[model samples]
Target: MAPRSAVLLATRNVLYVSIAGDLIVAAIKVGAAAYTGGSAMWSEAVHSLVDSSNSILLLYGVHRAKRTPDQEHPFGYGREIYFWSFVVAVQVFALGAGVALVEGVTHVLHPTPIAFAEVNYIVLGLSALFDGATWLIALRGFRRGAGDSDLFQAMRASKDPPSFMVVFEDSAALIGLVIALVGSYLSIRLDLPILDGVASILISLVLALTAVFLARETKGLLIGESADPAIVMSLLRIAREMEGVAHANGILTVHLAPRQIAVALSLEFSDELQTPALEIKVSELEQRLRALHPEVIAVFVKPQTALGYAEAVERRRGKTRQIVFHTPSPPGPA
Candidate 1:
């Protein structure tokens, strides 16, 4: 197993913070739901409960991902985090969103009146306080590698699931709270009990949408999304600048874990370089690449001339790539 480090454990502190706040909030919400019989409050309690459980799963995923590479899985357990994250997404949709919707529909059909509206108001206030603080903590590093990209773009580009998953959940929670507040207030003030159920339904929709978003993001990682474009570009520059290299064809990278990446480089080295000398150069090259990006756990070097590399890339373009991706256009002349 790779030694544990802060890098390997990205967003761990965030998960810890999330679990603590969610546990406290879940308890408070559960109590309030029992006291008030508000459908929205019950939904909120369930949401908090699911959030707490998801945080535990994420933490466990992070732990399991740190296990050493073995004969069964040579790339280490890094991508196990992706698998668990996907499971979290499934849980959100199945448990969190599904339960909220079920509760909403049940109350909508039954139209149960919420008692002691003040209790819900007080609980909402406290829930917001707790969720808001933790949301802010999760948001702190959201833009770390996003550069000048907008929020949605940054999220799409993010390679680390946990780095932003909590944000989605917390943001949905806060929105659902607002909706619940509105639903409850109108239901009580207007003596329309169904509005509270409507609010719960709305919260359910929010969670459902959040789950879809999370699942989509996580699916990409689980299947293998590339490292950040900037990371790939930087490593390509490093390869091109290395001694004895004539051209750096390109590099391929996949995130084995949030902080773990596997890289392969195709480079055209000087023809004068003999096999033994080329071996030393490749070793030094790997050292330089690792020094720059410790996340790059494995580097496979492929030697080929520029023209040969281009031809090889072109020949395999339609044959193999089409199996994975469908390009809009065939290759054009250089």
Candidate 2:
């Protein structure tokens, strides 16, 4: 199978596992919350439900993103994944964090003794076990995608949001479960039922932070992020080494999808090379680039003098700087 297809299948499998685990956990949490009237348990139930929904949305995004290139969208529908992932982040903030915060605050205002606190503890323990399993699955996928990078670094470097997003969501869920267990225990032992509400608030905070981080990460991709620096360097090196290439001015690379990159190169051919020779050289360079980096889907080579290319780049940079300087800043608080 193709690499892109492989990646999509792997993502779908992981999401399927997550969805199943979340459905089970949510059901258990809801029953426990109904029976024991624990605010934290209720919050957990909601969290699980939201997670399940997110998995479905991510799967849908993956599906939509895989659509073949069309006349309307010549670049294909790759950015659809970024768009839907951003939506997932917003949903996490709205449905997951927003609901949890409101529920927590309501419980804090009207503190109520938790019935059968032991039941909540039991459910939380089981839920933790289940969530941990799903978390491990996500972590393994993320680690494979990351190669040798650490978790935080992997998250930042990952172009595929679903890979890391699931990891973050599951990690938060596990932490929330631990907090709920502690809060339930403390509430029972100390007769401080309000601690349950505080626990829910803490869980909401975790979800909110995760949502914000996901949003920040996905925003760049949605707005057309560049390809990896290493990939860009490799492309330039390949072009420069070509026989008829006088100078490789610069390379511009952008990710059309996680595994799809579009490359544009400005090359100054040797004066000694004829038009036919330059055409052949360009084709050779394109093939070499694709061979070196299979992710490069499209390549455009433009014939230009090195001096002209440099001047154009400088003008572009100056305009960007001017725009940045002239942009209005938000007003500071009084």
Taken over the whole model, the C-alpha lDDT of each candidate is 0.89, 0.90
Stretches > 4 Å off in candidate 2: 320-334
* Most accurate candidate by TM-score: 2
**RMSD (CA, Å), each prediction:** 6.8, 9.3
Model 2 agreement with the true structure over 144-209: per-residue lDDT tens digits: 778886889879878899899999999999999988898888888999999999989998999999
> Which ten-residue region of model 2 has the weakest summed lDDT?
318-327
Candidate 1: residue pairs that collide: 1-68
TM-score of 2: 0.93
Cα distance off (Å), candidate 1, residue 72: 1.3
lDDT of 1 by residue, 36-78 (tens): 9999999999999999999999899888987899999999998
Candidate No. with top lDDT: 2
State, as a TM-score between 0 and 1, how close model 1 is to the true structure: 0.91
